[model samples]
Target chain A: MVFRELSLPVRLLFYLFLIVAAVSILYPLTWMSYTSLKTNEEVMLSPFGLPTRVSFENIAEAWQTGNFTRLYANSLLIAIVSVVGIITISTTAAYGLARYHFNGNRALFLYFLVGMAVPTQALMVPSFKLMAILDSWAAALHLPVPLLNSPLAVILTYMSWSSLAIIFIRAYFMSIPPELEDAARVDGARELQILRHVMVPLAMPAIATMTIFYFVFFWNDFLWPLIYLHKHTLRTIPLGIMHFEGKYVSLWSLQVAALSLAAWPPIFIYVLFHRRIQRGLTEGALKF
Target chain B: MANTSQAGAAIPRMRPSRFRLPPGEAWRENLYGYLFISPWILGFVMFLAGPLLVSLGLMFTEYAGFKKITYVGLANFEELIKFDIRFIGSLRVSAVFAFWTVSLAIIISLAMALLLNQRFKGHTFFRGLFYLPAAVSGVAMTFVWAAMFEKDYGMFNQILRIFDFDRVAWLTSIEWALPSYIIMRLYGVGHYMVIMLAGLQSIPDDLHEAAKVDGANALALFRHVTLPLLSPTIFFLMIVGMIGSLQVFTEGFMLTQGGPARSTLFYVLYLYIVAFTERRFGYASVLAWLLFLIIMGLTLLQFWLARRWVHYESEEA
Candidate 1:
């Protein structure tokens, strides 16, 4: 619709720019995927050429050697737990702020807003110390695993960093009319029931947005995982890929395969819900 | 924009006023409210506010992880400013990276957003294709870029070789190392573009019709109409992008490790090295605080400057 207003030359220029942008982004990813199928000799000898014969050997080898199964398991575990934790925690808070006229509601909302600006790096050192203390507490309780090197550490960290999520869901909840709740109240539904039946279902779009965003964040996050997860078994995909890169420094095909392994899961998610992801990100960003 | 209202304003007219509630009813409502929000409050206190205070306290002390803590009155800051040339270098690297990346991302992403916003063929496909890289793991994307930036037989060098140009030492050279990272990082600007695209689509068509009826050209339409409308999104991207770039770690950490004379020693990377590798927790805390302060200052500055250029629709009478 907007393009119809532009002159022919300007329209042509815009198309040119779009095509270039698309190619610039796509070419690299294509190269990485195809190169993952090539042998090291093939990669070195014909840098621009396609693989002599398409093969999954490099991917299999990298997956086995890189312990990617464990990495995928770990990453998926963290992402699921973190997204669920963040969404539930934030949505509940947002519902409270949006629905209630209680004392300190605004103050608590502002507190979360302020937390959003505090960089994660600022809290790293103390977080490590706090986790150590928590680890000792867990040990005293005879828990099976330590929080420091386990997925639980990152999950707990992820749950706490949902200020944006709170603000977002609150904005979402406020847009929801009070009549729905009032009607539910008139029907003798409890507050929690009203929330579960009315509010949550109404806010599924926003929740899904938060879920996708937080899932992507947890999956791709490098810094916290690097700091918290020291054990090889606990490594997530990004950390695992970095470790794989270090160990197989000279194996080009294996490295590409490993990188591809790390990239594919999130890419698959994006492809499936590209429209929702795009719309949600923009809406969420504007809210922020 | 609708959600920017305060708590009282956000409350619906159907709800009874706070003063009208009976004591028992008010108490019950408060109980329910607190019960609902307890999760976030708990999280904030446990994971954020508590650690923040601890970090602030640690900033004023000298202690390794295993050693007894001792008071150090701004000694870490003193050393950072008065000595520690590498600290200065890291700040410079971070500043340059932030400056270039934030500006370049704004320009490129906005342009792409505008282009994708047009009713063209394959626009949705293009939008997703562009934004696809932003969805990939940063470590993985960095590896692909690292391969492409390899000195010999890399994709970039092969193209250059075909064109009879000399192979550029993309990652190894001190000058190129930072820019290469910037280039690699720009691949993920698709998120910002999508945000901008949404901003563009939200712009009312009648407003453009009015502008065009007044004999405005394309440049004038963009300058007088589109830019002011999009300024809020631009301002947002600027602040968030700057904050992100200033605290950049993964690219430098994964690829360079702050090598080639620490040319790409991002501020966070250096702080990580200091705290984790060198066991200078106290000094690293100081570095972290300074970065926090710097980011806070820059963010405030952007807000101040945004008052001049960031036009919100709500401001219209």
Candidate 2:
């Protein structure tokens, strides 16, 4: 704990190591940001130099040419809807598991835990087929439901993979003292009322953490969108970036701008809420 | 919270006032639990389990997604074992990638965690900067990394030119491509570092103090005190890391397309090509099962080895 005791050479070495690690980690992002602002000629002539002209033209071009505005909106809608659904459904389920000692409770908990290890890739082919079947079934029944290639498909897929969040929340819930619930029960509060008023308030930190994690995952997801959302209009930012690359072959500046834009939201969120993310992930990983 | 009282009251009214529930109440509670988990369960059975079974069954056939699934018995497995040239090659490449990446990742992250455990200036900012990659979309970062590794005008080549070295074909050459992907992937060390730091923080300072009083130097103290306690975290990282690395797809798919003589053709990418592009659903299923078995076996082996090396202070040594 006493850093003053360390020798000068050792301290210098430690500082040098820290500098190298920081540069290695941050340089790519810095480079990307720099290149995004530069013109094509500038990028070709001096890859590492400051942009001679700091123009938002590449940003403007990437936004319009890559349909990034639409992609951003689509990604936002999917992430918000999915997080809402996951938090509501999983909180209720975790409440039941944490508060009630029912038959098959342990077995049911294990069943959900098993889903954690079931790789999404393993389920992709089947999920695809099921979506197709649902589309046909809805059509046959004359049910005016828009499911496939819609935001709904992406949301549902996201929900299926979000059981890990539920388990983490439930474990945290279990650690809460039973005295609070007993007091609520003595006040003749209904189960739903207790959940809404007491448990939810107490678990706000965990719930906030889950929301951020789920948002990042949903926002960054590529494979599910690639497989399910065939329409260009429904593509998320990740898929949109890929499509941009495919359409514009040599537009490196615009592509870098688009890539930076697509990657910025999550990076910004991480920077702002870095402590919460660390706490959440550490608590979940270590305890559970 | 109020549900506890309702449950408590409903239990006695429906049956005798005992700790255990009556048969009917038990059934009702079970039904409620099932109802609560219905969405995930239904999704699992319909989307995950059903397809998994179908894929398993398909392993014995020649189903190509569109054609009749002609029963081929063990022919796909047979070919994979004895005949397919790329099959074993991809496995070797995947094994090498998984082994090196996981080992290096563990070493680097643990080092970072140790450093971060010491109080430092701008520690939080550094932590955030490192972990930013975890939140960033892999596909988008890969795009940025692709440009960074571009042979002609890439920043990496420009740096190499400082040393008078020729430009390297990072993504095009079979020799350097896989290593490049590994390096690109290594930038996400922030996630692992945070986890390891958590584990390190949980260690009691008293233990280190005791070791120091016994004249133990830093290396000896770390060896005797730190690593033994950190083994469980290390073990968790190894298993998850290996499983993740084996299923590597995005980087290979985006950057290399498993090219340059298929040196970068990872096992999962090869299986994806077989299943989707070639329409060889049956063969793909066989490959999937093989992967499942290998992963399960390796995990079991890790657990077995952990019995010898992984020390838990809470458990009897």
Best by lDDT: 1
Please give me the DockQ of candidate 2 compared with the native complex. Answer: 0.42
lDDT of 2 by residue, A11-106 (tens): 778778888988877878877887888888897787678898887889888999888879999999999999998888778777777655566666
Candidate 2: where is the Cα deviation over 4 Å?
B1-19, B22-28, B67-69, B295-317
- Model 1 chain A: which ten-residue window has the lowest total lDDT? A105-114
lDDT value for model 2? 0.77
lDDT digits (tens) for residues A205-243 of candidate 1: 889888988898888999999889999999999999988
CAPRI quality level assigned to candidate 2 from its DockQ score: acceptable
Candidate 1: TM-score, chain B only: 0.88
Score chain B of candidate 2 by TM-score. Answer: 0.88
User: What is the C-alpha lDDT profile of model 2 across B64-104, one tens digit per residue?
Assistant: 65536699989998998889888888898899898888889
